[model samples]
Target: MTGTLVLAGTPIGDPSDAPPRLAAELTAADIVAAEDTRRLRRLTQALGVAPGGRVVSYFEGNEAARTPELAEALAGGARVVLVTDAGMPSVSDPGYRLVAAAVQHGVRVTAVPGPSAVLTALAVSGLPVDRFCFEGFLPRKPGERRGRLREAAEERRTLVYFEAPHRLEATLTAMAEVFGAEREAAVCRELTKTYEQVRRGPLAELAEWAAEGVRGEITVVVRGAEPPAAGEADAAELARRVAEREAAGQARKEAIAEVARGAGVPKREAFDAVVAAKNAGPRG
Candidate 1:
């Protein structure tokens, strides 16, 4: 019989938040795969639980290469516990590949629920959490980042992202450019840790603030695009929105769909609007 694979959530900031089952699983596993073996040691020490299993490093650098090995251990009926530096595994962290491999190997997979930076930031963001999406990290390059933001410009669901401190200002600037300066957002820094700060304001204001240099694990929550009021989104407006998206690097088809969604109109209506605009355009 295939062994079980446990994906445990570690503390993001306060070690005391570690789930009660996490310590027990860590102690009982036959093999422990940790994103950072050193951090794992510190965590275990804090919890006062010595692993009865062998611990191995399984970070982004080695995750692809190490997943197969861990899968084999699971196949051999060795109960494996996977933990990242913080939060849940496979959540913008290093556990997805291993979990996929375990499933392929017919191993039973389970999770130890704990704190999540994504959910935590969203809860405190003051933005609508009824519907939200986690965007993880954005591209490092300016153009790529802008393009990604543009793609989500018309999204009506609140968006969440993890960003580096050094790049926060630039990211906020890009968000303001793509999603509008007045779009509301919250920059959650060092969540659940001492000096935890949640700076809430418009994207442009947040960008200006981040310019002064901020630090810590950052989570950004941006309010979604507001839909136009009933009878407010005219054909010209829909066409204009689509054109803006196209200028920002989105394909015409996707741009139309996005604009339609934001305007609460049918894709066919948006497409017709675009067609009419093109037909009425000035000829060279």
Candidate 2:
């Protein structure tokens, strides 16, 4: 009979936050696959459980290759437990491959609930959370990052992102450029920890603050665009925005692309907004 596969959650910040079930699983599993062996040791120490199972590393670099081995163990009736450095396994972490493989091999899969940064940040962010998208991380390259930000600028639903402290400034700057400097956003730092802080303001303002240097893990939440007036957009207003970005030295094509992406409108619609403005003559 195949044994069960458990995806256990670890504390995102404080160790005391670990759930009871997490402790139970750690002490009972036949094998514990951890994203980082060192961190797993720390967790075990924190929980004071002295992890009963044989601990093994299973991070992003080795997840794919090591999954089959783990799956085979599960099939052999090993109570396999998967844990990441923080939060639950397979969440922007490893374990997905092993879990999928286990399921395919007729092994049972379960979980031990615990803390989560994504939900915590969303709750603290001043932005809307009724509907939101969890975009784990943006591209590192400037152009690609900008393009991605622009694509979500006009998103009606709130947006969340994980960003490295070192790149927070550039990320916020690009967001401001794509989503409008005036767009509302919040930067959540060191969440759930003693120094936890959530700074809320316009994207441009956040960008300025970030340039001063930021540290610790970060979660950025951006407000979606306001509903168009009368539930319909103002064509003239849209036209003005397009022209303004263009006047700021952005190429017509590039400006339109950026505006379109941010506005969540099609490229053709943005192009037409500009065309309508140009055809309307000077607005003395």
Best by lDDT: 1
Q: Candidate 2: global Cα-lDDT?
A: 0.85
| TM-score of model 1 vs. true structure | 0.92
Q: State which candidate has the highest TM-score.
A: 1
TM-score of 2: 0.88
lDDT over C-alpha atoms for residue 271 of model 2 = 86
lDDT of 1 by residue, 1-284 (tens): 88999999999999999989999999999999999999999999999999989999999999999889999999999999999988999999999899899988889999899999999999999999999999999999998898789878988899999999999999999898778889999999999999999999999999999999998999999998887878879889898888877776778998888788777789999999999999999999
List candidate 1 segments past 4 Å from native. 246-254, 264-268, 271-284
lDDT by residue (51-143, candidate 2, tens digit) is: 787989899888888998999999999998999988878878887788789889999999998898889998988678899988889999987
All candidates' TM-scores? 0.92, 0.88
Q: Model 2: residues >4 Å from true position, as ranges?
A: 238-271, 281-284
Global local distance difference test of model 1 = 0.92
